[model samples]
Target: MQGAVGELRTLSEGDVAAAWALEAAGYPPEEAASLAKLQYRQREAGELFLGHFVDDQLIGFVCGTRSLEDHLTEESMDVHEPTGTTICIHSVCVDGGLYQKVLQNSSKTNSDRTHSSKWALCETEGCGDPVDGQ
Candidate 1:
């Protein structure tokens, strides 16, 4: 949260670079997903790719693909199954500094609202079944 509350929305092709940047910065180099992978997610599973924006700047995101697998696995991470019913969330990244600020604010309300809405969208998409976070 900055001057205003952040809003969550579907990420599109245009948001890929920003999303990749946040991913790289939020996770260690070894754990970060490659730009190509992010690009693939944007192109193939755009519905599951969500960005948290404040003043139109991408600060965080949650991305994944639809899967029939019971849990997160190599295949789920690499492929998008449009007909699948389970969501395999690949990343949940937030800008480092902003994340700290939210913790300091000590209010779960904002974070909860964001996650709730995200899951709500997943449910609507018919892929709300939780798989282990990857």
Candidate 2:
């Protein structure tokens, strides 16, 4: 891949447009969250919204919310506590420029902020499918 790695950081409300556009490009209508919805999410748990930027452009992201439930539901998307044991990941969207093989080659991802050790990778896995180019 020609692309170089970007900064991995927590996204704030200022990045909403980029986040919304990225979501539109990365996910189908049935799956993509609306700007209002995204804004609400940011209000709920902005700390959980993470993004990858290349040249200051959003390329990918992983979004989630802290919860008490061991399992996930549609309601999980609407509710997010600032502190919780369970983190329900809602989406993982990557840029169209990158390929699956390249992503597979990538490992040991990191974020600038510190999180709790008690928190596990609560992967609310989406339908198993390859990332599609826009």
Candidate 3:
């Protein structure tokens, strides 16, 4: 199903459940972050947690924590370093039916270095994989 037009914004506490839903749906259970882990990231590093909302509902998200480590590590993935310069992206999830639509809409703005640079050093893992069968 095609979602209504959406906008990208920093995720908030209100978005926790919706974000977790997409996370669990888009990844294998072993790869998905726990609901508690998602909550911790939202609380500790909200600035790094970006979500795509369609008609007030979350359809996609890119969530992570800030870290000093050059690459994603067990410590960086579990902890949010307030003063860190690197962004260890943990989840990049999109609804199964809305992958192409959401990406087309978000890419124009999100691909800009200036916008992404705000988060700094985005070390994304599995960002290239398709979340849906598409």
Candidate 2 lDDT: 0.61
lDDT of 2 by residue, 82-127 (tens): 7655555566677766534323322223222424322324233432
lDDT winner, 2 or 3: 3
- lDDT (0-100) at residue 46 of candidate 2? 78
lDDT of each: 0.67, 0.61, 0.69
lDDT of 1 by residue, 21-72 (tens): 9889877788788999999998998877777788898887778776666645
Best by TM-score: 3
| TM-score of candidate 2 against the unseen true structure | 0.71
Worst 10 residues of 3 by lDDT: 125-134
State which candidate, 2 or 3, has the greater TM-score.
3
Off by over 4 Å in 1: 1-3, 96-134
Root-mean-square deviation (CA) per prediction: 7.6, 6.4, 6.0
Tens digits of per-residue lDDT for model 3, 1-134: 26356678878898999999898888888888999999999999887677888778787887777666555667877899877655666777887566666555444444452233333222354332212111
